[model samples]
Each structure stands twice: as C-alpha cells, then as structure tokens.
Target: MFKKTMTTIGAGVALAAAGVLASGTAAFAHECFNPNRSEQGNAGASHSQAWLTVHIDELTAGLPEDDAECVLDAYAATGAPTSFTIMVKGAVGQDGTIASNNPHPEKAGDGSGIDEIFAAHGADIVGSFEECGVPMPF
Candidate 1:
C-alpha cells in the first residue's frame, strides 16, 4: 500500500510540472499584428505589400503610459516592428466615430477587417515589426 501511494504521488507531481512547462513557455503563441502592448486588443494586420513594415498602437494616453521611451516591436511578415504611427483620439464623436485630426481614421482588423484601410491608402505595406518593453500584465 505504501509503495502504491508513493508511486501515485510521484506521477501527480510529474504531471503538474509538465503542465507548468507547456503553459509558461508558449503563453503568447498567437501572432500579433501590433507590436505595441498598448494595442493588444486593437485591430491591425501583417503582410508583404509595400516592402514596408508598419506598426501602430493606441495608448491609454502614451505608449507605456509613464515611460517616454517604450518600444513596441510588432511581429512582421518577416516578424518584428521597426516603428509606429500612434493614433490618439483627442476629439470626440456623436454616435460612434472618433473625430481624429488625420485625414483618415484608424481601423483595427476583425480578421474580416484585414487590410481594409491599407487598400484605401494606395500605399502598400510590406510587413510590420516593433520593440517595446514587456507590458505590465494586469
């Protein structure tokens, strides 16, 4: 009986260890279009269109909120971001539109929303990448 108890306990410990290994190593496995942690839930895309890697993000106010020099490295078609064009909604909208200063408003992808804005720009984006310090996990 004692032998059996030890064997069972040992098996349980091994299984627990394996679970931790798998979950920790590949926690962020899904490919992200935006490099900025600020834009994690926002929409975007990654492709080889203009041979240019584009990265943009929406900050709570600024990328990394308090830090002035935060770099959000986006995953490029080649896999990583070089820079970003940050869009901040300074103005307001009546129903659902953000009265942004730029000529165009930003559109994050819905998967179905992929490259919708890019197609309109007449500018081809090659792929995107970025480099920001790790975001503070809430």
Candidate 2:
C-alpha cells in the first residue's frame, strides 16, 4: 500500500538524520586542540572536573561582550587565559572579582561579544592551559 511505502520511507529518513547528527556531535565533542600544550608543567587534572566551574571571570572580563566565539576561539588557541580563568563558577566582574550577587553586565545583554573582543586583543591577554585546572577542547 502507499501508506506502508510512505511509512518505510519516513523511517529511513529519520534514521539517516539521526546518524548525521550523532556523527556531528562526536566530531565536535573533542574539538580541543592545543598546539602549545606543554608536557613540562606539573599541573595535574582536578578530581572534581566540574562543568562550567572554570572561572574565566578575570581573564574573560576584558573580552568584548558581543563576541563569545572569538573569545572562545582565542582561549582554545592559547589555552593559557583559560588555564588562569578559575576552577570555580559564579558571578564574576570585569576586573576578575568574584561576588555573590550581580551577574556581569555583558552576560545580561544579547549583543555582548566577549569572545570577539578577546580575539581582537588576544595578544595582549596572558594565561595558559597549564593554568587551567582541567583538559580543554581546542
């Protein structure tokens, strides 16, 4: 019947789509590639390794609020600033100060391009993957 044929085709399409999505997710899951990764440092992985705990408040504070991609990319490239960001999470200030109240202004806006700002001035910032407490995805 036409209904049976259509059902088979729909299932096939769904399976194909799922396969594509799974492959893409796997590829991006481990995208961290640090070219300057050092083996000489004594920095060891934290036992906690909690998500979103990497405190980049101070390091990322200088990043322009509009460009999160650029900031993330630069961090991915150097892995230093990220290392120094923080092992904990919470409200962080532009000056890298942590507070119990008041979320960052840039984080509140839609056009906050933090990464683009960092990427534009990545040469000026300082930090390293050795400083980051956990492994990073480049």
Candidate 3:
C-alpha cells in the first residue's frame, strides 16, 4: 500500500510539472498585443507633429528601409493623431510589418485601417506576429 501511494504521488508531481511547463510555453506564444480588444486610448493625443514624427522614427529605427518608409508614408497620409505598432517576424528589418491604428473621425467606413493603408502603400503584409515586450498574462 505504501509503494502504491508513493507511485500515485510521483505521478501527480510529474503531471503538475508538465502543466507548469505547458502554461509557460503558452504564455510565450500568445504575448503579442491585440489591437482589437485593447486599443491604445487616445494615442498620439496632444502630441506635436514633430513629436509624433520623432516618435515614429524612434519606433521604426531598426526596421527595413522599405518597411520604415511605408510606415512613415502611411502616418503622413493620415494627418491625424495616430499610434504605431511595429511587428517583427523572424528578425528585425528582414521581416516586419507596421500597424498604424488611429482613431480619426474621418476614418469611419473609409477603408483606411492598417491593412488597407499598407496595401495602398504597396507594403508587404506580413500579417500578425507575436510582439515581444508586451506585458504578459494579457
């Protein structure tokens, strides 16, 4: 009976360890920002054009030339308060996509969302990738 109890306890410990590891892996996998559910509140609000431009340049500093240019162009065209999210896939510059989700009054039903903006600018749509540095447990 003691041997059987020991075996059961061992099995339970193993299962618990596996569960912890699985949860950690899952957390790492889905750590990216989800704009749909958690949009930045009043992003770029009360910010100057120079400030915004500098902010964007800072964000896209290490990105590919084309990708960075695409982001800049899209932001420029908007001419509104905007927020940018840089998504890097594989490695920075090699594969990346920028998302500019601005809350502009005119954007309603205007087809000027990130996908459309990227498409309009001839930027390659890398789709969604995990955004690192986002707070975990999100």
What TM-scores do the predictions have? 0.19, 0.19, 0.22
Off-target runs (Cα >4 Å) in candidate 3 are 1-54, 81-138
lDDT of 3 by residue, 1-138 (tens): 996565345434333332343344121111112233223332342132111111223334456776666655655554632332212121234222222222342332243432222222212112111122211111
As a whole number from 0 to 100, the lDDT of residue 31 in candidate 1 is 16
Residue-level lDDT tens digits of model 2 in 1-138? 996565345434333332343234121111111223233221332222211112233333334554444545555675444432112222235232122232442431122222121222223233332343322222
The alpha-carbon RMSD values of the candidates against the true structure, listed in the order shown, are 20.1, 18.9, 20.1
What lDDT is reached at residue 103 by model 3? 38
Q: Better model by TM-score, 2 or 3? A: 3
**Model 2 score (lDDT):** 0.30
Q: Where does candidate 3 have its weakest 10-residue lDDT segment?
A: 25-34
Give the per-residue lDDT digits (tens) of candidate 1, residues 1-138.
996565345433332332342234221111112333333333232122211222233211234453323423232232323333222211134222222222332343222222222222212121221233444221
Residue 62, candidate 3: alpha-carbon lDDT: 52
Ranking by lDDT: 2, 3, 1
Distance (Å) between predicted and true CA of 82, model 2?
1.3
Give the winner by TM-score.
Answer: 3
Q: Which 10-residue window in model 1 sums to the lowest lDDT?
A: 120-129
Clashes of each: 24, 25, 0
- Judging by TM-score, tell me the better candidate of 1 and 2: 2
